[model samples]
Target: MKRTRINKYGIVACAILLSLSKVTLAVDNVTPISIPMVANAQVFADFTDDIPAVLNYFTSSTKDEIIDFYNQSFGESIFQEKNESALR
Candidate 1:
């Protein structure tokens, strides 16, 4: 009974910590802008493709090149992290 109680408390504590971390990370990284946002205002028509060829034009090396390009283009202060994940 005591062990089960401890496990429940431990899980709750972990969940709380994880949520707090996410909140802090988001808040710390936010930049203030003067613009109030509008919802889904599109200047261009939507794509008509059944299966969109997103990123297919980009070669494998384009991923790394994109990161480098953005870092150079934006001068690194606005962009802090680059993370890439792929599933087989």
Candidate 2:
């Protein structure tokens, strides 16, 4: 009986911790891409025009953006160097 009570208390404590640990995410506001429209691109045009935006959505760039902000705060030259190195 004591063992069962201890188990019950342990479960209750676990449940409380689990509930507290949950983080509610805000709704994803990014619009979904229309594959059909993208497929309809002109025959001469590149098919990957919209691919960058789609790919960038999955890659969180908050760190890069912050770095860029600090770099730009210094001057355009440093920012340009950073962009050039990224291209390389």
TM-score of each: 0.30, 0.21
Which tens-of-lDDT digit does each residue in 8-86 have in candidate 1?
A: 8888999999999999897777554332112323324333232342112223444456557546765576546544554
TM-score quality measure for candidate 1 = 0.30
The local lDDT score (0 to 100) that residue 78 gets in candidate 1 is 59
lDDT of each: 0.51, 0.45
Clash-forming residue pairs, model 2 = none
Error of 1 at 4 (Å): 10
Off by over 4 Å in 2: 1-4, 24-81
Candidate 1, residue 2: Cα displacement in angstroms equals 17
Candidate 2's residue-wise lDDT over 7-74, tens digit each? 78888999987776663222233344442222223333333433343222222346466456546665
In model 1, residue pairs whose N, Cα or C atoms come closer than 3 Å (at least 3 residues apart or on different chains), thus clashing, are: none
RMSD of 1: 13.9
